[model samples]
Target: MGKQLGFYYNSNYCIGCQACETACKNKNKLPVGIHWRQVDHFETKNENNDRQVDRYISRSCMHCKQPACAAVCPVKAFRKRPEDGIVVQDREKCIGCRACVHACPYKAVAFSNQAVKASKCDLCIDELRQGEEPACVRGCPLQVLKAGDLREMEVKGVVKECQGFLKAATGPSIRFAPEKR
Candidate 1:
């Protein structure tokens, strides 16, 4: 693992306990009502089996292949690493116009009301540099979150589910394997 990038979420294994969510908030030191990561649950009934099954979705920054947030940032706050495609923000340069928030289709970009700037998942580059995984992925009890190379993960048959700007422009590097319910 030489500075690789991307996120892999196995919905089949996720418990929707929000450990990832809390971990992200704590690691980032976000104030109340600020979320860099979140868990979403969708429930559906199987007509054939007369059973109800719930699908849990873990969502955050996709750190896309072609990020709209970076493109729309007037101050050039958003950046993507050419080697790994990890999109990040330079807080010092950010003017907090909320342009990135509007440009992002995934709604992944979060504007800090106090800091007066936008923040989102950077895939925890600092942690990776320290030879550690992102806080959320590490804190997950169910071991559902995996971060690494998109090419390698796809080759391993990790099915990806994309939404919003990601579906249109592939703005994030997050992949998901939905559980069959």
Candidate 2:
């Protein structure tokens, strides 16, 4: 409920390199198939029928103002941090119920086979505390990813909805700069 930290992605600048995914996994020491951050590819024909246009989206937990995952957790394992508004799951309190996984609209929550818990991105709270950007943001080869205060990014004309994203009443924190036509 404090500063709402969020991500901004410029689709025009992304190349679907998956570096962000790699960096997130390495930084969090996540097991295989448990991706806290992921790159998604989309292809569509242009309006003029010239050729296929490919787009890539880097996505993770958006740290929504009303996190459905937190609401559905029977054990109250998920919490939105008061200081930075980062949604985090307390592994110890998680019951592996998968309710959170089902509740999250972005499909960001994943069950970790190694840890036997539901896990999602915490926005690298520790790194943020150190005044460092999240690994995904720092590792992007194209520099397409950015993280900061959501309000500031919005003021700069970044939008919350894009080609692969839908508007959520929860007020997801991430923003997008759509690819140019």
lDDT measured at residue 129 in model 2 versus the true structure, 0 to 100: 87
lDDT of 1: 0.80
Q: Write the per-residue lDDT of candidate 2 for residues 78-138, one digit (tens) a residue.
A: 9988877888888899988899998899999999766778999998988988999999999
lDDT of 1 by residue, 13-76 (tens): 6778999999999998988888889888876665477876666777888887779998899989
TM-score of model number 2: 0.95
Question: lDDT per model, in order?
Answer: 0.80, 0.89
Residue pairs of candidate 1 with colliding backbone atoms: 62-172, 62-173, 64-171, 64-172
Model 2, which residues run further than 4 Å from truth? none
Cand. 1 TM to true fold: 0.89
